[model samples]
Target: MKNRNYIHLFANCLITKGISRSVICDLQRSKYVLIPNSFADLFSKQRYYNLKEAPRIFDQENLSIFHEYVAVLKDHNFIFSCSKKELKRFPQLQLKFEYPAKITNAIIDFDKNSNTTIKDIIQYFLIPYNCRHIQIRCFEDMDSIFFDTLITEINHCFIKSVEFIIKDSFEQDYTQIMKWVENNRKIKSLVLHSSQENKVIQKENYGFGIVVTTRQKITSESHCGIIHPDYFNITIESYTESLCYNSCLNRKISIDKSGNIKNCPSMKQSFGNIKSIKTLDSIIENPDFNKYWTISKDKIETCMYCEFRYICIDCRAYLETPENIYSKPQKCGYDPFTNKWKWDYESFTK
Candidate 1:
């Protein structure tokens, strides 16, 4: 194997910090493997050695061990005998230093008496360059005309998908709303929260992912939270190196009922007031506005060694240690050291 001369790592593969080990991810293949610390140390040198040279350099008594390891890496197509220039032909993984906006989604909160128009909200709070998902929460009753205006305005903006959550007592002309949802492709989902009964209708296959459900009243405590493992996994995130592991904070913005812009609705730090800001572009451009966007799971406390680190939705607003930004999530009881997850749904509500 040494006669093959030079060997190099695949350009698409990424190395991430792991717990007493290293994680090797092939971003192009969407595959990952955990390697020993020894292998990581050698790889970190950036000098890929041939199979025969590995035993000589590491002084391993068992040459078979090194051979087996190389064979496994070769089988995964993570190593190549080709020259460094040949690997350069493949697209190099790059991380962005200055992203357009850390906010990929924007949450718009509306109370019973909110008079803010859809046009004004999109123009002032929505940064078209980075925002794609929009969640509109209405604690008050909203009629079809309101949705019509919202759908029309969102259709004209750069927002690709929208989810509307309204209270059950709010009467809406479903026929008109459905028609508008079908007409405007951006209206992707609708959720109704009821204070009385518990019922759910599955219209996920419709033009709009519609779910009319009954739940408790909307309060600061009532929140629907979940983490999608598929999109949040390391295999997928390895390709998006610049963004944070928390998808919610990866280019995300939220507007409160008072039209204050924040990292999230629960966060107290207001970047700026939407009504007073001329454009959201300037607000997002501020370094302080995106302070949390770079805090990946590996940088977090207990999350660093967790298998679910990438799949977990993080809450920067609440922490196990209030003063520490790297503290574990207050709601999570996961012990990565013991490989046990004790998170309870009841605890999540608080």
Candidate 2:
């Protein structure tokens, strides 16, 4: 496919970092569209009042009450930021991320133990909700019997698509995994994490109908359709960054581990919290939280003139705090804002 073929508009914002309904409402008035984690129930009971008109609606001591009012606005699936007091009003809300209904499939890296358990919790909770797809993390060294048992259990559960991470250094034979996938047509996608040799496998063996490479080393030439560390900018020298090109092309919901959710994993700040209001509907109705998704990258001054803006992954993590996200993510090689590299300009030019 062509470079622009994979262009995607991402709804950037995390509910956990604190964005309020009023703020989101203000943003919506400015013409921004949002994609919230929860659906709509979390904010249904609340009413809206102008900050100037209802100056005393909430006491200074109980700011959380005000937060609840704004959070209710967020149920509309908009994006905005709120405060601690506002977030407190929704005590049931936790610090988590939720995807929109349209996005039924997701691949989460179980980087932490909590992440692993979180997957199970999601599976249990979303089953009744009729979620269609899920791909869980699995270590390669685990026993084949364990994989078989896991596959059997997953097959028994309410799932349409399932994928297991194939690590590069795993001792298990890929043939076995491929065999299981072949038998289980329920699996629609397969991802290889940090696999250099497996890059060759996609071309040699046609067993995997759809294969994607999650780490950096594998490229488009390998026919491993997807690539990760997507939070960086792209250039001709780094063509592999386009791996997410077709995959996320028309995607509406985007997720990142940044504590604060905003457009792009590299951005700073957030719209609201997902756990505070456990349902996706709660996030859909909030007017205040809707603007982030609607705003185009071209409107944002920094991105408008950059040569790589259209192809590069705009990240909230780096924008939130450059030092913490990446010391040297690929796109960081040159800064459009300053027109200089963090290192020597001559070296980058050469």
Candidate 3:
């Protein structure tokens, strides 16, 4: 044999298995590729690679199939061939996940008759916590004065990124709303639901992303967990965290339209009324609050066997069996056993 070497997968290309297939998550590039279960078996040996042992992975008839998968893997830069000595120099990526803040993100919903004002909310919650991300869902058209005040006050808060979910306005030119989001440095997305038309707008600075969903009104948290591939998060932090912790509820807080704080706005339980809750610190410390934080995909039924578990966010509040804490997500329509993704009208709860 010539310069024989071992084969190695890059530290970031993590593979996860389902019952019938596998998902290759490219953490560095924020993408994922699905592969057959048989293709994943090529790595089961987990040893040095050489021409002599090629037969160990494939017989004469299956050699072409092995070559096909190898080609696909190489094309995506998921694997590399190295000398035997070089193998010892490479180490697998550490799979630990940790967030510096007590609460990492938040979702605050507002309706036409919300009890509190946006200014008070900023001063009370956003200013006190070091939350990195937030989602503001306005169920109805908002007052121009309050909207302007929120934009100005948000600049002084700890939220690094935000997404605004609002109903499209017919009273005012929606383009003007888009302009505000475009100029704001922290606003990542502006989703306009219940619109006349469906479109996605991304122009220059302030118009980074303005999504329109026709005939769809996201009035509450019940609209979550749609389970679309477009919503998957392939980041290293999200992937590793999904391995051990609940992706949706971990270090997350939500405040519904009625000012009731919860792990998710759709859930029945509330920590306290935002107006009366002394400190979020007390609520986060309560054992009843963090109970769902650790219920990861590995512990969830059906999802435990899916190859896309780590990349797909989990919804603890809405499940196939509400009585069972480990029930499968009702919004998920993927059939991992059949190696296909399909939406079943009867299966989707909301």
Please report the candidate that would top TM-score against the real structure.
3
Candidate 2 lDDT over 16-94, as tens digits, reads 1111111122211222222232322233343212344233554664455545644554554443344334433433222
The lDDT of each candidate is: 0.66, 0.38, 0.78
Query: What's the lDDT of the predicted structure labeled candidate 2?
Result: 0.38
Candidate 3's C-alpha runs over 4 A off are 1-4, 45-51, 203-213, 344-350
Ranking by lDDT: 3, 1, 2
TM-score of each: 0.67, 0.39, 0.92
Model 3 per-residue lDDT tens digits across residues 238-310: 9999989998999988889999989999899998998897478888889989989999999999999999899
The numbered model that scores best in lDDT is 3
Tell me the spans in candidate 1 whose CA falls farther than 4 Å from its real position.
1-9, 26-42, 47-49, 52-91, 97-104, 127-132, 138-144, 165-182, 188-251, 271-290, 293-299, 304-313, 344-350
Better of 2 and 3 by TM-score: 3
Candidate 3: residue 153 lDDT (0-100) = 69
Clashes of 1: 6
Task: Tell me the number of clashing residue pairs for each predicted model.
Answer: 6, 67, 3
